[model samples]
Target: MNIVHILKKYPVVILLLLLTACEEDGDKIYLSGLEASEFILTETDILLSKENASKIVLSAAWKNNTLVVSNPDMGAPDVFTAYLQISTQEDFSSNVIETEGTGESKAYTGAELNAIARNLGLVPDVATPVYFRLRGSIGANMESAYSGVKTVYISPYLIDMTVGFILDKDKQQTGLTLASPDADGIYTGFVGATSWYNFFMEEGDGKIWGNLAADGSAFLASSEEGSWNFWYPEPGGCYYTEVNTVRKRWSAIYLPALEVSGDITGEMTFDRPNTRWYYVFNAASAGTATIRFSGQGDEYNYETGDGAPAAGKVTIAFAQENGQLVLTGAAGTISVQVPAAGECTLILDLSDPKNWTCEVTSGSEEPEPVAPEVYVIGIDDGITGGGWNFDNKLYLYNEDNLAYAGVLNVHSLWGYQIGTEKDNWGDVYTQAGGDAYSGTLEFKGQNNLAAPAPGVYLFDVSLKNLTYALTAVGDHVYVNGLDDKWEFNQTLAATSVPGVYSGSITVSGASSYGFKIYLVQNNWNMLFGGSDGKLTYGGADIPDSNSWSAGTYTITVDLVNRTYTIQ
Candidate 1:
């Protein structure tokens, strides 16, 4: 090196010498101020749910999701962003869907960060429940799955849900019932335990329609008639039987839901507008995990077709206690008007730092049981519809209990008049013989001891609460007060006037046989005379019949004419 270059560089040595002599810039010391000892990562937990419906909510929580870096001076976190990652048990692979996309980081403050994590998509509509996961972010930093990944548990829900399932009571709460299919569902009568009744439905045309038959059953309780004669005449003695059938259908069907709730879930309600769906579902990532709700409700007014609007406001009565979100009144007891033709859904903002969030799942389908047909026949058949002719006064007495509630079947049919036509099905009434009106119960006349088959059998006996009166005539006794015509075992005949003036009647059947007699008024009314004065009905007897049965022909006095005649 040159001495000049060395002198230039050595200038600092002379400067240092001068400074050292002055003691001002003698030596320079470097020191650093206190740096933070440690940075701590505070942990936070959250849950999400739906609102409104009876269902609980959708949510899951875990404190391990966040890491604690332990910087004592580090106060509560300022910004929190959550990156949600989701996967199905089928595929553990991690990736974001296309339009379905991945969950971007959602941010929150310290206060709001400690609570719930409901996303807007958690709102329930007509859609079903789907599964997914969530991951969180802090400030501008990203947290890997190992740092913060959470799986969620969700269920079906709605704004306001109530149950109606029972079938035996006037009011339904929970029991067996046929699932309502739709507007076109028919009112079918079937045989149930309660049995012997029918249900009417308001049809589209505004008319009420009824269905009934033998072997069929109903849910409503029924009336019974005492034992009389149950018989068939062809190549037989007494063939006794008594069969029962009843069927019914409900107007509005109801179902319940699965409930879920936690501090982190929100309320769920019905009515949803879909650009396509209420919440979009993500397959690969937690694209859009959605809890859904199902079932139906309507005021006196009802809707039947599409979906409701997303922006419209729902009139929900929110109760702070239990977080009740009712579409009706505050007590949830009020009835409102339902739209004429659409499905509706209400969405709640769950992504915000609300104390709760709710996610709901819709409903699933169930299969219904198959049913059988029913039949009712013979005079006094006790049926509402079916082709029948019961004008013949030949009444039956099957050894079975009889019914006389309100009006009998016979009188109800009188309103139809002779030859009066109606649907192929006849009016309510009873018939008298074999295969008559396709009946479930048939009464067979007995001869020897084999007490008829037990349980319920078809009977040909009917009529109650009335009686037929007649003294006697010279030869034949009249019925219904009309003379000259007679019905002998279903065969028609003409007779001469009796000398006695009692109510004229035709002697039906052979004089030697014991039988039941009635002045049948239409199809439901009947009057008789005997030991009980109530009468020996159907085919069953009082063990003795000589007095009630015909013997030696005799004369009788005339009550109206004050005259007498002998045979």
Candidate 2:
């Protein structure tokens, strides 16, 4: 290779670099002047218009501190195809108030979408200092026409009008304060989520207000209310079918899958797990009523008329073992398990003699679906002694007491242990090496061990592979997961002193996993520390303080066989 040849190769590389120049491209979407698209808001702004629309306005001040925004057209039945968007400007990236059409918002009809976004005191609706924007599109991909902005308001923050709150379980407060800069800032003339489906809100007294939209106004303010349950989406459009005895016995549940005129079709259902809805009529009842949809757009909606009941109505949302999902508004719960495929259904329809006979009211608010508390033993009912049928739990159980609060578990298994090491039978018993933990394994639900208990206790920590211990005392409890080194089950296997449940021996094993453990005064407090366990009344390390209180105190054994232990 000659030096001249090398120089020629270098020149070729230089030429390539010169031709390759980095280019940049950028485009922005501002709701401004997009076209005459749809406009969605939660309020009509009693401050702006004399009539408080079910939803039409957004306003706030720094005083409100909290950021607030929602779908402009929430709870209206126009089927408007607008999304609740937000930004400092008309652009997409300017700090959004609402995420574009996720979850229920995606398939919401004009009214459904509006109700979701505008529901007062709901999540994603009460936040302040939010920016909002919305646009309308036709067809699934929004390929058709778009709408224009009808009215404009300026604020430090604004939430998209297309976004609204669905008054499901999480936001079921008795009376949530809708923030307002001044009393006038947030006009409640429009009914909040409570009266949204029933009445229109209008400004009445100087301070108080009343429901007014029901009288031929605000989308009929339909007396129709739907129960939140689950069933599969029937292909022939959503309809209400009464459950027969067979269906009730089989625990067959239906979920709903809804398509937002365009975009995506979602299947909706009950919040329970493995739950089924069973509506049974008494044999004496001569008639059966069914809610059917005549056409594709037809829905068994706007429940009206005081209505009449059949002979006997049995509505149940039962768990696998509980009674059928036959609910009559007494006081109970239905456990619905989310299936692996499709959607679930929960509908409330006026049956038989329609005259508003079935007046619907909200049920107990479902707590935010937190991971249920649970307990996991090294033994899984799989191995001979280790396998137990006991289920995971939310709280702890000792003996027979449940409400005592003496529970020492953040997560646990079934409490009622059914079988023995020899038989290895029954559902609650999990086998552990030939020995059974016996007793029902405490099971709350999932991983809700993040709860805190009372009194002072010790914690064990192991990171990477290093082990460390600490003593902590607090009135609250909170746990994330069971880090093997987080805490230990310290209970006495034997006792030297006799206290309240004197002969009670603080047995080893079973304490709050992850975090906090409580000291219930009356119930399991003594039982958990009962029998073989000793309650050392005035000890420095016991659950009872230097002279205790009455509440059931969760006691832990500090030493083993008189061995020198950390007191």
Query: Global lDDT of each model?
Result: 0.24, 0.24
Candidate 2 structure quality by residue, lDDT tens digits, 1-567: 001111122221211000001112442211211233233333332222112223334431110011111223322122224355544344445444443443212322223333323332123323332234444432253232323322333211223322112122322212222222232323211111110111112111111122122422211221123322111111212222221111211011112332111111222222222121112121222222222111121222123211112122233221112423222323233332222222223232222211101111223222234222222232223223444333422222211111111122221233222221223332122222111211122222222112123222222212111222222323322211122222333222323321111112222333222122222222221222211233221111222232332233343332211112111
lDDT of 1 at 510: 36
Q: Please state the error at residue 496 of candidate 2 in Å.
A: 16
For all candidates, the clash counts are 134, 161
Q: What is the alpha-carbon lDDT for the whole of candidate 1?
A: 0.24
Model 2, residue 301: distance off in Å is 30
lDDT of 2 at 296: 20
Off by over 4 Å in 2: 1-279, 283-567
